[model samples]
Target chain A: MTDTTEAFRLVVVSAGVSDPSSTRMLADRLTSRVVAAAKERGRETTVTVVDLRELLPELPTALSSQLLGPRFQRAVDALSEADGVIAAAPVYKAGASGLFTSFFQVLDNDLLIGRPVALAATAGTARHALVVDEEMRSLFAYLRALPVPTSLFASTEDWADDALNGRLDRAAHELVLLMESGFARAVRNESWKRYQHTFGSDAGRELGIDTDTDLMRLAAGGSLVDSEDPFDPRTA
Target chain B: MQFGIMSVSDITRDPVSGYTPSEAERIDAIVKIAKHAEEVGLDVFAIGEHHNPPFFSSSPTTLLAHIAAITERLILTTSTTLITTNDPVRLAEEYAMLQHLSKGRMDLMLGRGNTAPVYPWFGQDIRQGLHLALENYNLLHRLWREDVVDWEGKFRTSLQGFTSTPRPLDDVPPFVWHGSIRTPEIAEQAAYYGNGYFANNIFWPKEHYRRLIDYYRKRFEHYGHGTGKQAIVGLGGQAFIAKSSQEAHAQFRPYFDEAPVYGNGPAMEDFEEMTPLSVGSPQEVIDKTLTFREAFGDYQRQLFLMDHAGLPLKTVLEQLDLLGEHVVPVLRKELEAKRDPEAPANPPSHADLVKAKYGDDEPRQPRPNANRGDNVTGGSPYQDSEAEVSAYPTL
Candidate 1:
């Protein structure tokens, strides 16, 4: 438990607006794989699930306002705060859904830097399945997130296929190994892990940081200046 | 040079342990799988949305946003963003927001999904899915490229001088790939606008996709996007590999034997006989995939489906290791060597285009008057002719 908590947090974030969707099914399979693999390694783990549907109606508006609003600061605080995330969506268009994507645009930049992610998608048939790899993987790469190699794709047929269950189990084991590798080889890397969030202290007024010098130092990853009252909103 | 991975969120029993992973577990799988995709040098990770039972991904953009938070250099796109079912206005705003978050590493595939039940769920008529796709995409295209839009259509409410924000990254909207397995109309749509065409080649034989790809390429040339060979293409594939062919087949056979699609009447072997799903050794998978170019021409993207058999996470990870260390490198090298210099290297990147369009400058000044007839450069029909405006009702 100590190692798992200290090692990295795992988050499975899915936006399945449907009651029974291939996207949700695939997400479940992958999660089981990761959990099982972790257990096999005797590594204790904690998992969190944030269903975008629960946030819906308000999701689009909240994501939009949080991204474009003056107070957009609160947007994506959780994403920026997490160590690992599993992002899933049902394929719409030739890409991700507009709602699913808006949540990302509002996030602070440092949030995704060098973090690990698993990508999953669902479609009606097996035909458009490649869109996951051809499009979503590239999106993550650009954001500097470390995505896993094996992506899961499901079609309507997968629902009844007992074989799909086997695939999900394999995927779970695979993910645990990959995450373990990520934790062991790269988790503690400063280049990869040091920066979790960034406050453009220079946007002091905008972000509410006070001292320009202190903001710059903070941005540079240096200690802040010693002040009589460091926590004061005004100044020390 | 395009790469990606997709998830179909299905809650099912684990083949080995008979344990059904919860919806939360499935969602978490995407995060880990996406990370592995990046680590192994894949290019994109996309999610699909469905509004029915057992399928969980109802909102792809939300999932994509989370993916954007954890990856770099992996282009995030969707397999099917049901252009027919979703509103253009909401879709516009969502993708625009993604463009900003991913620094333009986002793009999408538009399709009319197979499920008919989704139409009523989203207040759409299944019969009108194609029409709605064409109409909505037209509006979405303009919304991403145009600043202010004033229009009305059959399926959607009128937009009275609406502006979706935060304006696509650097004024360049995410590139689109119109994907279809059976619809020729989509191929024409993709070609008409010079966007990419994606044929998910999982079902049917190579000849089926060849026709679609050929049709798209021909129309693309007709539309003057470039030569027929320069038309963008992407393909879909499935795999279940182990060290040896026998071992891999032995392990995956049961899952395939029980696959909902492959189970019962057709049998797993029969289903594989009809589609590109490969349940064999890594070499066999690679070899089978290499034969794709013979049918689809020089495509830009290739994605594989590996995590579907309910094989548990351990087996899935081993497969990833094989793909990263053996399969992908081989594919990458072979694919690169086969490229034609004149062909588009990859999809048009928004970041590069943004930089090219707005170099060393703040975001382009909002061109309030730039599209006026006096300044129009014949780029749009609405520029000089108010008659073109009549096609759509005024907001």
Candidate 2:
């Protein structure tokens, strides 16, 4: 009963610093909105959190050495394959933390290229709220990331105010919509194209069923293509 | 040459515009500064950690994680990853996870933190800070370098047979830089292990650092990590650059006055009197920094602090524009020309981790499924725990 084309994977990357952390709160809000929007659109979603605060302590050694062990390799594989990503952090000293910056230094540039990213930050006050747009967004641009237009900024004031919280809620909703649109575009274009090519080339020949009833039986038998146009012309 | 910038947060007013930005503004300013650093072709950007009032960056790793999503080439590092108070177990797991999230662009500076109150807050004693750093880092080092560590120490519970999950990319842990302002022990530690020794020369004079750097260099040579200069070295700086020297000074004075550390403390006078805090044109900053070579010898990494003191985002951005467009280019050309062929190639970069992981054909065979579950490796610079045991047992 599972829909083959209905699931979307979403990742929320929160720095997870313990005190006065608006970043985590914003990440939760964004995830909630993204999940809600996906639900409204009848798409199932899975959210994974990369909590930096929790994960940073256990990073391995010899990061710059030629002798890479097994554990670090697996982490790289996950990031390169992550679907939709949401990165949230606490603003510090005008830029990302050294720990946060160092984490980015180890990644391959191509992995994040064209990934849809939603950036958010939390701070004690609102003076540098645009840092997400200025510093973080700029970094994404360099990475060739497809960053969503709306970045959420939560200061102490915003967290305290009902009106500001409402604004953040709206922003989160929009962010998820953007993420879904990006995901859909990727699926409709890339995944659909691949699916079409497979069916178009080998559909009838591989199934070994000539008649329509046979084709239906084969399809029911889980050996044949079932789409309206298995050999999709849109991709062709 | 990996260049980075770390800000010591101090809420202050902008000298030129007279805008007094809050702590939040200071954080944003640094982010903009970091972005500009990346745009200008700098390889890394780092931030400091401080937990008291007037200093905003209590959580450096979280901020770096956010930045990880932003830049492609700019590696993120901590100016200081407190080694004394922070539990090694948490440090290992969190950084490993971040390595996965960022793909590989991460490293950190291990330090015995300066704050005293933080010791008790984390249920540690300030007096035992050095002992904690030594023991914790040793355990941490093993946790990253070994597959399954059988570790025992005085500070934390020992691990008989522990394997940190989510191993780093290509199984390479992050390059560590031990940052010390005054501690000779830290420098000795960095030298003993062939790790980078970062003499954050922000507050002290050239002479003050010479002794430390010399000690590190001598010890590094003694440990057979090649010649003294080849021993991994890095330094911190502070600067305010504009088109004209007068403009830079005029625009930065008020901000300096309001900087909490430099605002009311002796640090400002000492900085002006002895240390290098360039409030001038880019060339002046360059000249001041070049002088550090004489004192500390040719170091590997050089970082700057340009966005502190609540400078407005606009000013910080402009400074970065100058740094990228003008300052760094000249410095790179000049520095490269002066380099000796034997100088160890600019310390291993972040991109190397990925190349090691996927590039190697020999180790690509899929690991056994059951063993994979037990070892769950990651691609971060830090090590994982003996298992995926939560470092925050309290959590």
C-alpha TM-score for every candidate = 0.57, 0.56
Q: What is the Å distance of residue B383 in model 2 from its true position?
A: 18
Q: Give the Å shift of residue B165 in candidate 2.
A: 2.3
Native contacts matched by each model: 0.00, 0.00
Candidate 2, residues A1-236, lDDT tens digits: the string is 22345566776777757854667778887788777777777777787776666545333221322111233334445555555678887888877555455455545444555567778888877887888888888877876666787787888778767875565566656655655566545653455333322111221111111224322222121121233333222332
Residue-wise C-alpha lDDT for candidate 1, range A56-162, written one tens digit per residue: 54443334222122223322445554556788888786676665665555454545666678888877878877977888888777666777776766778877888
What tens digits encode model 1's per-residue C-alpha lDDT throughout B136-204?
887888898875677765567777667676677767778898888645567777887889888777655
| lDDT for position A204 in model 1 | 17
RMSD of each: 28.5, 28.5
Stretches off by above 4 angstroms in model 1 are A1-236, B355-395
How much RMSD separates candidate 1 from the native structure?
28.5
